[model samples]
Structure formats: structure tokens, C-alpha cells
Target: MLKQYKESSQQTYAYGLVDHLNWLDANRLTVASVRADHLRLYMNALTGQGAGVYGVAWRERPPLSNSAAANVATVVKAFYLTSNQADPSVVAWFSRDSSIPQHRRRAVTQNPLSPRRGSARPRFLPDEIVTALFEPGVLTSARDVMVVTWLVDSGIRVGGLCGLRFPDLHLVRDHPCGQRKDPHVHIVGRDDNPNRARAKAYHSWRTSPDGYVNDGVIRAVSEAMIGSFYAYLLDEYHPNQHLVDHEQVLIHTKGHSAGAALTTGGVRKMLRRASQRADLNSYITPHAFRHRAAANLYAASDFNADLVAQEFGWSRAEQVTELYGRSANRHTMKYLTEAWDSIPGRPTGRD
Candidate 1:
């Protein structure tokens, strides 16, 4: 798991596996002893359907959500598959014949308890709430403002945003790094970052011979984003001379951790606090801005999925279509209304 997945993902799997292990111990069941039926019972216990040996423990906590339970099932299945590989005697509860003849003879089957995934959809913040967030006194910190602006404008993931470095930003029309005609920022992935924040799409970036990143998921920045960044640099960022030099773009502005790189967790907490201060009814997460950006870009481009995918660094246009294609904007709504009204022999309520 550590070799195949990121540290964060591996940690999630480890935590889930621990719970499974504890449940197995309580039930006196080993990997070889557990069967598909037993695993289904485990899933039931997780979702508060059945409490096998730890009824008291189960009652203390709320049932896991369907998605979370599904994730646990996935982790358990993966664990068993890996265990089976390490020792052939271990029961492979999720193994089945491969559908493709040329592929491996055995394949891992999906957990019966895992929920079927629904079609992807945009989960964006409304324009009014966004306006309220930016209103005076709502978000006072220049750094906070910059962070929100970049998220909304660039649709960069929280991890990528926090992982940014000074060298990744080219805030001029003509930067020495590349031939881009506008200001942009690069999302680079590095495993050794002290904050453990990394770009989700790490494969999209590479350093050039001159120590400049000319190939990466480059996102154009809005003038407002640049202005807020400059404000943060001038008013908030004052790195201590004694600390070791690091080029992380976003750093703590106050407290003992001042000048340290901000983590993705910090960014999330900031957004939550800001949302509360703004009196927002719904909690606004960093990813909500990405959804808004994708929807807005899709609408602005006359519903062009390809353009939205390209702008947001999506690997496939199908991703944009599945996620943002059906997101209705004012323009789309108006067009549909007009088309409906223009249909021949259509009933008019007034008539």
C-alpha cells in the first residue's frame, strides 16, 4: 500500500484495516477463516445493521456513511487479496475469473456491500454566497482572500494549492520560464514537501534543464488573485531570518508556527472558519470553488466540455462532461426556456 499509494491514502487504508483487524479479533476469526458471508456481516456491523461482538462499542458511535462503509470494504478486500498473494493458503474471498481472456486468470471482484457509484455531478457554491464571502470584513486576511481567489479562478485542488512554491508562480505576461502570454501558476508534485501537501496529478509536471518548470498543469490567474497575493506578500508574509530557507508560497502569518508552510488541513480549517464568520448556511469547502470554476468555465465557453477540461487540467474531456456538463447556468436555462416557448403548437397557459 505504501509503495502503490500516497502517504495520506496509505494512512487511510491502515486506519480502516485496524478497525477490521479489531473486529476479527473480537470475533475470533482469521483471514483464512473469514468468508464472504462473514465479511457481509462485518459490513453490516459498520453500517449499524448488526453488532456482532462489540455491540457496546458500536452503540457509542454513529454508523458510518454508505460511502465510508464502501471505502472500508474496499480496504478489507485489498488487504485480503494482498494477504492471499503473500500466502496461498489464506482465503481469497473476493477472487473471481477474469472477464478478459488474455488478462490474468483471477481478478479481484467488487465487494457486494460496496454501493454502486452514481454519475458525477458538479457540487459548486452559489454566486451569491461567493459574493458574500468576499464582502468587506468577511475575509480580512490578504492570504485568505488570495487562497479563495486562486481556488475559484484556477480550480486548483487544495493539495496542489498548498504544495505551490515561489518558483511555480509566473505573475507576469512574459516570464523567463516559458512562452506563456499571461500570468499563471504551476502545480508541481514533490513527495518530500515538509507539509506533506502534493499535487493530485503529479504526472503532469516536469522540471526543465534551466531549473524552470516549463511543463506542468499551468493555470491562468485572475487579476484579483494576483492583487490579493501581492497584498499578502506586502502586508502579511515576513519570514524569520533564522529559519531555514524554503520557497513555499503560503506560510503561517501568526503564532509560533509563523513562516512555516501551511498544510492542506490548515487551508480547510481556514475555509470553515471563514464560512462561519460569513454566516453561510452551508459549509463551503475548498473543493466547492473548483466545482464553481468548472461550471462557470463550461458555461462561458458555450458549454464546451473540452475547453473546461483543458482549463482545469483534467486528463479527459469525459470527466468534464460527466461532472460539469449538466450544471445549469443562467444562459443554459434561458436558452432552454426560449426553445420550449418557440415549439410549434405548444400550450400557452395564458391562452
Candidate 2:
């Protein structure tokens, strides 16, 4: 079962199944003897008195959320299916229409415990806020500014940023790095990164096949962003001591962990500190830049959904770009109306 799953996904499934296995052990219920009622009892226990968040141990904490419960149920169902696949004799016991009374049809068919997902607006950082981040003294060090710049320019996830390596960067305008015409950075997924930042995908891509590089997705970044990176490398980074020779892109500027790769938590902390220094009064997350960039691209491209989707690396099935189109069109309509109103004697009164 784990062999067919991605490393990250396998880790998630393994973690979720621990609770189910523990409950099974406590009740003396083997894979061959488990029934729907037993699973329901486990679900009840999950949300009963206390349960921590997803990926957390089943200890005395708050009750499991609807989404969390649904996730656990999904993992448990997958476990049973995998077990049955490993041994055919257990198939009848876990079948949807088996004679086992109290068998859960919902578990096999769908997750009834899952809440209906509602459409929610994507959060974005305002243009002013992003601009303020680059102003002198807004961030404590040049590295923070560079981090925020990469987030805005490339719109990569925090995990991708954390996993960035010096070799992955091709900032030169026309370097012989790969076939790509523009400057870009490669985002590679690795489970062994020191910072614990893993890319969402396993396959690696390159803009140009200049040479064999780390396996990961390639994303084009703005020249300004690349310049900011060099500025950090020259000023704050090289002058500081400790791990003078490192391959990671972003590093801890100060403290005992100086020169180490910045973890996801470190990135969030830097954002909070930068926001406070800039007097923004609101903590801007790295993901917010993704939404902002997507919406901005839609408006700039005259509400072209395909272009926005391609730029953001969203799959065709993920039609969430349509929502961004709607928002973009509203702004365009306002501009069109203003332009019409400016015409002399145009629609001065209702006809």
C-alpha cells in the first residue's frame, strides 16, 4: 500500500492509521473481525471527549474537526482496502454489500462525515503592503526582503521556498543553465531537506536542458527578485560567519542556527516581524502572495483564464481560475463605465 503512494502521502496515511490500529488493539478487533459498528465506535471516540488536530496524536485535546474526522475516516478506509488487497480472504468482511450487519456503506462509497465545502474568497496581500516590504528598514535583514520578493514574484509555496538550493537558482539574464530564455528557479521535492520543507510534487522540470540538475519543477522569476537575492548574498550573508559554505538559498542570519536553511516556521516568523516593522498591522502569509499574483495576472491578461492557470501551475481540472476571472471582470467593468461617463453628453439622463 505504501509502495504505491508518494513519500509525503505515505507518511500522512501511516500517521492517520496509528490511531485506528491502537483502537483496534484495545478492542481486540482484527482486520478479519472488524465491522462497521467498530469503525463507528472509533469515529465516536475520535470526536468523543477530546482529540487533537489532524497529524497529531489522539490525546486529551479539543474534539476533532469535521474535516479532520473525514480525513481520518478516509485513511482508515484506505487501510482496510489495502489490507484486503494484500489478502483476498478478507475481502468479504470489508465488502460494501457483505452480510456483516453494521457494515458502513458510507465509508466504502463516500465520506458522509465530511462537511459540504463552500466557496470562499482567496486571501491576498494588497499592492501597498507588498511594496512596503521592500522599503528600507521594513525588514530586519536583506534575507527577509529577498524571501518576500521571491514569494511575490514566483508565487511558490513556503515548502518549495524552504527546499530551495543554491544550485537550483539560475538568476543570470542569459546563463547557459538550461533551455529557458528567462531567469528561473527550480523547485525540487525532497523528503531529506534539513529544513523539513518538501515540494508538493516529485517530478522535476527545467526551462532549458542546459545540464542535469536536481529533480523538481521550474518556475520563472522576475529579474528584480533575482537582484534582491544577489544583494542579500553580497551584503548580509557573506559578511556573516558560521557556515560560510552552504548550498541552501535562504539561511538564518543570526543565532546558534546561523547559516542554516530557513524552515517553514522561520519564514512565517520573519513575515510577522517584517509586518510589525512596516506597521502593516496584519500578518501576511506566503500563500496570500499566490492569490494576489493569480488575480493580478487575470486582470493584466484581460481575464484570460487559461493564461492565469498556466502561470499559477494549476491543473486544467482546477477551474478555480474562473473565480479569479469573475473578480477581474468586475474591476474591468468599473473602468469601462468610467470611460463611457467621461464622454461629453454621454448618458447624462435616463432615457
Candidate 3:
């Protein structure tokens, strides 16, 4: 699983497996003996629809959300499939229906537990909340400000931001490293970082003979982002450079861990604290900035999903289109209203 998935994903699966294993123990059911019907019963218990022996364990907790339940089901199914490689009989338990096509049979048969994909809208921070967060005293440190600025301006994943190395940053235009004429940062995916902050995307990157990165996903930075970065460098970063041992761009600036590369967990904790200080009605997250940035880019690019996808390192515009279709609808309605108003003979609502 470590070779096939990111550490974070493996951790999630491990957690889900633990829950399943506990439930199985409560019911005295071994993995080899559990059938499709038993699995359905387990799902029912997870969803709070059935009272199994494990019900006592989960009685105090709320039922799993649709997405979370789906994840657990997926994890369980994957576990059995892997087990099936050693024992072929496990396949019969999952694919009991003979009518199902051979190619269509999946390890996890879809049931009521499956979540409807593409139904939920991506949550983003509102402009007013973002403005409030930027106000003086809301974010007290240059490092915090720079973190928010980069997330909002570039829409890079928090993992990518935390995983950044000094060599990945090309702050000057016409950098001696590559042919890109604008200031940009390369997001390089690595599994070996001491911080375990890995870039989600797997775009290939290699350093040039001159010690500059090339061929990674390049995220263009705004002037504001560059300014905040410099502020962090001069005001906080440079003063603490003597304590650093690694090349990662973002690092702990205080305590015994000062100068160590920051992790995704650290970024989340920082945002949570900043959000609380800003007196926000709801909690803010690092990915909210990415969502807002995508929406802003979608509107700024004249509703071009392709451009938004390219800017955000997405492999396909279809992913962007699905995520930002709501933005497109809002802009399209505004344009339609303006077009109607332009017609001289059109009746006003006042009439």
C-alpha cells in the first residue's frame, strides 16, 4: 500500500480497516467467513440502520457520513480482493450474482452505501471572510500571511506548498534555469521528504545542469504573492536561517523544531488558529483557498475551464468544468441579463 498510495491515503485505509476489524471481532466473524450479506449488515450497522453486536461500540458516536461510509466500504472491499489473491474462494463471496457481467463485477458491489459522485459542491471561503482574514492583527506573522497569499493566489495544494524546496522557487522573471519568462514555482512530488509532505500530483521534474528545476507543474505567482514572500524572508525567514538544516521553503520558525520543514498538519493547525483569531463564523481550511482561487480564475479567464485546469495543475479541463460549473452558470446569467437590458424595446420588470 505504501508503494501504491500516498502515506496519507494509506493511513486513512488503515484507520478504516481497524474499524472493520473491531466490528468483525465483536460479531465473531472472520474475514474468510464473511459473506456479501454480512457485509451489507455491517454497512447497515455503520449507517445506524441495524443493531449488530458492534452497535454498543458505535452507540455513542454518530453514523458515518455517506462519503465516509463509502470509503470504509471501499477499504473493506480492497482488503478482501487482496486476500482473494491467496484464496480464490473470496471471489465467489463478492460476486454471488451470476447474471452480472464478468467484466462489470467489481470487488465492491455498489449498493445503498455508494455516494453519488459529483453531487456536492466544492466549499470555498467567501470574499468577505478572506478580506477579514487579511486585515491587520488577523494574521500577525509574515509567514502566515505568505502562506495564505500563496494558497489564494496560486491555488497550490497544501501538501505541495509545504513540500516546496528552495530550488523549486523561481521568483525572478527570465530565470537562468528555464525558458519560462514569468515568476513561478514548480510543484515536485516526492515520497522521501522527512516532513512527509508530498505533492499530490506526480508530474516529472529534474534539475538542470545549472541546478534549476525543469518540467514540473509550474504555478504562476502574482506580484502580491512575491511581495508577501519577500516580507516573510526579510522579516522572519532570514533571521532564523542559522537554525535550518533542510532546503524546504516553508519551515517551523519557533520552538525546538524551528527550521524543520512544515507538514500539512501544521498548515491546518495554523489556519485553524488564524481563523479563530479572525472571529470567523465558520472554520477555514487550506483547501478553501484553493477552491476560491479556482473560482476566481474561472471568472477571470472568461469562464475557460481549460485555462483554470492548466493553472491549477489538473490533467484535464473536465475536472475543472465539473467543479466550476456553478460559477459558469452564475456568469452566464449575468451576461444574459445584460444582453436583455441592451435591447431597447425590452419591457422592464417595473412595467
Comparing 2 with 3 on TM-score, the higher-scoring candidate is 3
**Residue by residue across 269-290, what tens digits does model 3's lDDT show?**
9888888988988778888788
Root mean square deviation (Cα) for candidate 2? 7.0
Task: Name the candidate, 1 or 3, with the larger lDDT value.
Answer: 3
Task: Write model 2 residue lDDT over 278-302, tens digit each, in one string.
Answer: 8987889888887777777787877
Question: What is the C-alpha local distance difference test score of each model?
Answer: 0.76, 0.70, 0.79
Clashing residue pair totals per candidate (backbone < 3 A): 0, 6, 0
What's the CA error at residue 299 for candidate 1, in Å?
1.5
Could you tell which candidate, 1 or 2, scores higher by lDDT? 1
Stretches of candidate 2 above 4 Å error?
A: 1-3, 11-73, 80-110, 205-216, 240-246, 278-282, 320-351
Q: What TM-score would you give candidate 3 relative to the actual structure? A: 0.83
Regions more than 4 Å wrong, model 1: 6-8, 22-30, 41-71, 84-92, 97-113, 239-244, 328-331, 339-351
With a 3 Å backbone cut-off (N, CA, C), the pairs that clash in candidate 3 are none
For residues 1-351, could you state the per-residue lDDT of candidate 1 as single tens digits? 434666647666777788888888877878777777777777777887754523224234687867677778778877887774333432333554334364644353346556445665656578899898898888878889999988877778999999988888889998778747799888767877788888877655667777777767878898988998988888887544245257888888878888888999999988888888889987788888887888888888888888787777788998877777656454567789889999999997794
Model 1 has how many clashing residue pairs? 0
Ranking by lDDT: 3, 1, 2
Better of 2 and 3 by lDDT: 3
TM-scores for all candidates: the values are: 0.83, 0.70, 0.83
